[model samples]
Target: MTPPVASLWRRLLDWWPRIARILTLAVSIVVVVLLVKLGRGIDWREVFLAARGISGPTLWAAGALALSGYAAYSGIDYLARRFLNHAQTIWKTLAIAAASYAFNVNFGVLLGSVGVRLRLYRTLGLRHAATAGVVLFGSVTNWLGYCWMGGIFFFGAVPRTLAAWGIRPEATRAAGAVLLLVACAYMFLCATAARRRWTFRGHPLAFPSVWMALAQSGLAVVSWNIVALILYLLLERQVSYPDVLGITLLSSVAALVAHVPGGLGVTEVVFVDALSGQLGAHEVLGAVLMYRVLYQWVPLCVALPGYLAVELRARHASCGAGGHDLPEEPYER
Candidate 1:
């Protein structure tokens, strides 16, 4: 090859990953724009009115469900600890889980969530590698649940859902089959090779036992259902539970794939598009707004104070110990 041609080819190879990332980001932005335009005709006044009309009983029910959902989220940490055979206290696990999730749900996962978890777990005397294992285990737990429940719902209820969106039944069934296959493959791996470990970046990681994997998947499904119930309650019980579950599952996948902060614009777009038939645009928007406030904002508010307290105690302990290092702040990264 000529020198210039060889140089150009090497440059293209070097830049390929970055180019692909840029293209993905551009596409995500366009999707958000189109979805926003689709819902632009919604009446803000009606949305506010719908929000205000939610009864006290309904609000209470939603709040209770939110609590249950978060409790299940905390259980993810417990399950991770059990899988690792770590002896951390229940209070510590719950505290770290709650605070980390509160941050992650609003911010993107890698952007903030894992950092918060690492900091808190370190404060509780977990080493860096062990902390990473916990984070990995928790993440795997979430995806396992997503795949298992998502596969079931997509195969059963969501084909009808796609039909509403004008998608062909055959295509929808194929997608569901793919999801189920992936879930089954993971379960098979756990059953056959649970004791195998892999190393990444100098850290060794092991898969959970078959029973533990099933437990993790089950906890994740229960958590997801509770969250969906919260949304259904916020929507004043107008939409059926199965529809809400399917929509929520698809919306979450969209948000994750889009890589948007908190899946902010992406989630709104998916929700409006999916639920527009059962509820008016304004009503759907209102329910989403309420769900965000109750499910995301409120938990974050409660968690921040707890985080602050942890930091203050760590600082105080560090000062008294004369030369001890303190846990890094969540914003350091």
Candidate 2:
């Protein structure tokens, strides 16, 4: 209210974004350091042996599910392309999406998902801001689903491991209530916000329709469930799906917050702790190892070549590199 205080407040507002990034980077460094220390405490030989104990059939099944999960991920971008009315073929959209997601999981967002998508989408005719819009849409859509699923599961069936951390069911349920409220608010905005748009830096993105919002949430929830199912199957269903799903979702938070690639060691540590009551450390680590192979590495291996090939083809094709391939409507400012 005072002029001096208001000036100070304005300066703080201007500096907040930088302050947040620095804080986030510091936190990620701490998390990664802790993860490294925790990782050293494990007996990797036992983890490897436990992986060897897995049956071939289960491995094959997990592989199949991984494919399905990746396909669903690509579907997110397909929705984005449609939302943007971008004139691109389905196969190309899928290729870019799949490759970007694969990178995103294996690398961090900037290095993998966002970077890969921006590069390939540019080759496919999207401008920088247009690609940013697509990336923003994909990001928002995923989190909406996460909120929906997290709120439902946390409220309905608190993770068994929460008790270990002295976290009360009531607390998680309260958190779930909050998450659900956020999801509902997004839905309400989609329905009534009337062509609302968000701008960060110079890139502006429009909100999807209510139906598209629901579709995004539905697809994302399924994709996330399939991820949990992969781990469950690898563990031979020894752990309850809700418990497994709860841990899986929680791990995503750690990785996302820390900006770790594919969550790397973060996921293994979280799973081991959450399921310690039901399984040995080795068993959990083994399932996680198999999960990394099937879900992350294999996709990365395939995607790398696919990405190079797409880039090569795009370079040879008669089109402006990094220029719009199609006439895109102006985004609402």
Best candidate according to lDDT: 2
| Local distance difference test, candidate 1 | 0.78
How do the residues 1-333 of candidate 2 rate in per-residue lDDT, one tens digit apiece? Answer: 699998998899999989878867976776667668667778989989999999999999999999999999899999987888776677888888889988988898887768899988877766677687788888888889899999998878777687786799899999899989999988998886465666655865357789999999988898999999999999989998888888998889878776677888889878887887889889999999999999989889999998898777776664654543554434432
Extract clashing residue pairs from model 2.
125-325
True-vs-predicted CA distance for residue 84, candidate 1, Å: 1.2
User: What TM-score would candidate 2 get against the native?
Assistant: 0.85
In the range 228-287, model 1's lDDT, one tens digit per residue, is 888788888888888888778877877776776676767667767777677787777778
TM-score for each predicted model, relative to the true structure = 0.85, 0.85
lDDT (C-alpha) at residue 127 in model 2: 69
Worst 10 residues of 2 by lDDT: 324-333
